[model samples]
Target: METSDLAALTDRARRLGADGRRRVLGIAGAPGAGKSTLAARITEGLQGRAVLVPMDGFHLAGAELERLGRADRKGAPDTFDAAGYVALLRRLRHPEGQEPVYAPAFDRALEEPVAGSVRVPADVPLVVTEGNYLLLDEGPWAPVRGLLDEAWFLDADPGLRVSRLVERHVRFGKPRPYAERWVAGSDERNARLVERHRARADLVVRLG
Candidate 1:
């Protein structure tokens, strides 16, 4: 069933504590799976004590992708800097006594990543992070599996996922045909890859 209320998540976070014992929650799912939406809702329900750090901020820039001939494989597992993301999460896992930690954020309008977009205060105690590969057991992503306090895998109907991807691509300026191609080629492929990781997650959530 879909979980809209985050009271359970927040209560768990409070018990985990911050500054080395903070609860780090991970919501993993494929493209159009609503991972970001769920993370945002959890953080919002937790009020000011919770902060979100998305993995999308680590996406390679368009220019860089062109240089590497990877622009066409934008949503592939290889398109992101998984190591960098893990390193940042590692740092957050052990927050200093009273020092805040900063994390990057992705800009939808500029289609770029910005540094220091989210500042997680020292005592906030709860961190909700969402991404596609969080449960994947490959490469640098392998280490990510051992970091989270609780990992959730989200599942949505394939048709709905495709529809959402097409709408999002068009809203982001891609032509209809190009958007469909991306959803079929890139997004669909990534979805299959992520589905294999559902077994590794602590919970599997179904959403419409």
Candidate 2:
């Protein structure tokens, strides 16, 4: 079923952690579709019982993207370290004895991934991971769906999503014109790819 109630969503996440066994809940969405925002809210609602591990942290460094000639399409599936992200999911699912797990974080200001920026304590019961490709069924992304205990796909109006992406890019220092172009060109292309996998999610969330 589709829902837009934030309180109900947060309550659902709370129940996910009630068993005390570590479980991962994934929030997948297109660019500017609110994946990170939803993940953070869920994590905060859990009151330290859950942690946020974003898939953006697995983005290939700018230099590597340039070397592979994929810099222009930075958010595409091929531009991220997909396997590494999957491996981290596995580790979070089954941690070593009494040890905390560390995950990378993306630094939006630097436009780079910072290694070991998130620490998942051994006692946290839920891990909320968000990304664009969590429900993708191709190549390395195929394993991600199985790793998640529950997955939610966020869908938003196309025009609103594009506008959010433009504002985000401009806020991050891109000129308004370039931000608009990049959102229309790169972000929208990836958004279409992500939207195709919507049926794979356990739930579909529509935000107003």
Please tell me which predicted candidate would have the highest TM-score against the true structure: 2
Per-residue lDDT tens digits for candidate 1, residues 70-140, read 98898688888899999988888888778789999888778888888999887777788999999988787
Residues 41-157, model 2: lDDT tens digits? 888987899999999999999999999999999999999999999999999999888989999999999999999999999999999999999999999899999999999999888
In terms of lDDT, the poorest run of 10 residues in model 1 is 1-10
Prediction 2 global C-alpha lDDT:
0.94
Enumerate clash totals for all models, in the order shown: 0, 0
Candidate lDDT values, in order:
0.84, 0.94
Highest lDDT among the candidates is held by which one?
A: 2
Model 1 TM-score, all chains together: 0.92
